[model samples]
Target: MREIQTKSTSRVTAQATDIVLRQTDSIRLIFRPTIIDNVKNKEAALKGIFLYQKKSKKAAWEDFETIPLSSVKGGEGYKLEIKTAELLQLFQELTQLYELHQKEGVPRGQKRYVQATPQLEQLASLSDSDIHSFSNANVAVGTSLLSKLLVWATSLDDPSPLIERLVEINPDSLSKLNAALGMQSLKNALASWEENECISDEEFWQESLTKHSFVLEQVFSWPTSIVKGKAYVGGKNVFNQDGNIVDFLLRNRLTQSAALVEIKTPMAPLLGAKYRQTYNVSTELSGSIMQVLNYKHSLQEDFQSLTGRSGDLFDSLNPQCAVIVGNAGSELDDPAKKKAFELYRHQFPGLTVVTFDELFDKTRQLISLLESEPRVEVESDDMPF
Candidate 1:
């Protein structure tokens, strides 16, 4: 490394073209400084920090290969580009340098390392034995390395390295992996319902819809309807009169018309009892329907005020209302009970009533559609002469 010293009118600054701070048998870390244009007044600044690798210890420093670093258009901070191949060795060198710096005291204008994230703290706490055991662990070790590689690879300007690896994977295998992930999500949602069967907390159900607002989309016959922002819109309108908080407020992406949804637990009964010949809608279901209807009325009444405050144009004129409650598959197992429930909902105009199981059943169908392989028809050219 060539040492370059320049004198400025203010003070004298001394630096080297390449100052090796840390080194191993084959690799070395260096501080490269930018040479000043004029020796009179200009002071040289750090151009970059780099890692250089040599084939062997006996190799000349001039012939050392420079590892590529992330290019900063113009920034005060320096980012060293570390590849997966040299990650472990670089990590070891960095840790030792950090320890030495801590003992000596951090230089002026340089910030000392602090454990910010939980991940960094855990990494800092790892001992040599712990690191050895971690590196030797089975597939877990590979998984950790792959995760790091994925993060690094995705951040690159040209991510074709990761893309190439993915392309090498069989298409059928990729499809299967995608299907498995979809099935797992469906199973997780079902498991939540199963665990909280008896719990009738509206907030719990509300939270589920908030996380997976796609469930609300199934209520609308029009495919364009979607939850505008959050599933829950505040109860009160501009006037706050006759204010009733809606569980979910969906809008047609094309028409920009709004829709209201009220959520109830799956355990809520769909039908009460046989009145005359057909079953009557359960009191809980009846109340929820009325509640959603009232919410719609409140929204429509303050349509202009609400729309102005929201800043998004929403057509509150004749907005559709829906009530999602009960589990039809489990509760209305009887053909007669199912027919009565269906007839009532179908006959009800401007309002939709859907069962919990029915809503999730639609979600399952979507997953099935995603998992199903497309049929390719082959055109045969054969003449029967």
Candidate 2:
């Protein structure tokens, strides 16, 4: 299932080259710079981090290797609840890595207990020894390392309480044996955003839509309040017979054709060079509008075949748009790109568009506006199909 909260935009063009250029930040930062700087030696820290990661990943390999139905009998409900709980806990911790600090675990100021999300607490598969170690631990990654975590965690709203506990663990527990023994803190090793002495880094580089989506799944998959639906349907590999699905078909009613996202690193521009040229608001103006024209075309074809609707709602009517999301006072300044994007928008009316700031503003007030009313009523009993 997917979450309901999000921002939307229209589609654009791309190909194999686009795919190559489209590497998510998650894949780019092997180990956070902050973590590396504090680890004594870069190579050694990376090795340690990888080892920890590999340890936690055994669950995936084990689950994949084992065929559930054959291995377990009865208590399927309990078994499912157990596994889902584990995955959710893991996902929450992984997500905290993309927040403002970019490290892992919880940040300063917030309550530590929030880390114990329902899934984390419900995970009973953990071994007794591992549980003991987890309970009595104090994580001591360096300040730089914590800074990186802040960057990553900023991407998420609030991590689970267990994650907060992991971040506070001691360094000794991160060793090979300790990590393999179910060191949940290892997930934080995914990133270490260096809070370089440059205020520019914090000022300019804003998170993009793609980056937002990437962190969402990592941070929270099974929501606290479940959204009943058939499945999630975007980020590639999502298609339905009609642009429409049954009312309950989607876990999150807030689905879109495709969205374009851009990543900004506060001071990426001040560093000059390629970073300066690519990050300007004007430069990114077009980035949001044209994220997935190719995907839109593909969906159009599929939707047509499935629904056989009268008009070209599937083909000619591709309502994909762009969203220039990120921090405030961190907008694009380039003029040419802005002009081109403006021209494109004037030409396309159906395409929804906005910046991350704009999206945030709307989201905050939207809840009240929506609550004031309700979903549009459907008087006709007949289904569109």
Candidate 3:
């Protein structure tokens, strides 16, 4: 939830007319562009991302664009209640396959494929009536089964460990274990264990099946684009003595916010902004310092008319913050990466450029949180939705 305060001098581009949210299983994608191209002196590249969210005063499960990426912690904006009956049928079939593996010792190791078992064949051959019968008898059961199967299929990579353990515990009668009156204890155990456990922590499998990796597919910098210039034309004319008037008064989110932000990787043009006189005065990483300074200056001069309150828009007590974030590899012999921060330190003195390691771990946590709760659905009407 804590972020590098980002002070920007560019207006987000693209005034989207409407947006659509698309989903398949756990993945939700928003199909539209949100970024304003203030960089490169050209129009902003509007790209869309489908991600969960945990951000903001409104906390609306918005169309992703409603909140800043920096604020959308690992929070899935909202969860669509998945169907139950379909999930049940899938779960029953998967359980059968799992039981067969236990009885046959998982055929040594079945990371990808192995000979089909009778249980698997039976499950595959189930008639529509059979699946429907189970669903009709117990709607909850059906939904639970379907949900489990879907989660497992989409999430699991190797079921060897769960299979091997089951097989080891019950010799050839893995499927015919404890049956009380009409309940199956082994089945229940599998249900309780598999449904609640993390796929990565599944010890039944030899190793986790797949890997989840996130790439910084795209990123944008604040203020002047070497190509397009700043968001405001005739840059000087855009500001008054109060700094960033229209943007500050209009952007309550900007005037009353803070974060720890940076620019790294393919850092060529971005670093160019650090050479200005305003930035040269600081001992911190040049880029961030300059950005903050620019943000402050712009707001002070331009925002006065709108807010009718002048002086610093950012709270000096809690004014916006800026930090350089670069890859850990930046610390290596790479001259550009090392030199950027080195100059950063010489200029900013106590400024800290966060390493890629911290960036990665923190981002991963944020992503996970987003995928779950999503911090959507506004909590109050006072906060902008």
Top model by lDDT, which number? 1
Error of 3 at 239 (Å): 10
For model 1, give the 10-residue run with minimal summed lDDT. Answer: 1-10
lDDT of 1 at 351: 94
Estimated TM-score per prediction? 0.55, 0.24, 0.24
2 or 3, greater by TM-score: 3
Better of 1 and 3 by TM-score: 1
Worst 10 residues of 3 by lDDT: 209-218
Mind giving the per-residue lDDT tens digits that candidate 1 earns over 1-385? 1222322222222222344555788777665442223345332222334645455788766644543345435554565665564556545544443343334322222222233467756965898688777777756875687578668787876565458878998999899977776677766776666567567787788888666666667788885455543333435646845355677778888888888888888889989889887899899988998888887877777677666776475677788988989988778877889888988888768998988877877877776776689999998898778
If both were scored by lDDT, which would come out higher, candidate 1 or candidate 2? 1
Question: Total clashing residue pairs per candidate?
Answer: 1, 60, 63
**Would you give me the overall lDDT of model 1?**
0.67
Off by over 4 Å in 3: 1-235, 238-288, 306-318, 323-325, 334-343, 346-352, 355-357, 365-385
Please report the candidate that would top TM-score against the real structure.
Answer: 1
RMSD of 1: 15.3
Q: Write the per-residue lDDT of candidate 3 for residues 1-385, one digit (tens) a residue.
A: 1111112223443232212244444444332323344356432233333344444554444544455546655754544343465445434434433343345322332123344568667766888799899689999988797778758765766665566656566554544443231133223433432353333232221111111111111111222111111223112543543322111111123443322233333122223333433223122235455655565555444444423563343332232333433334433344554565455455543233444344344444544454465457757659566
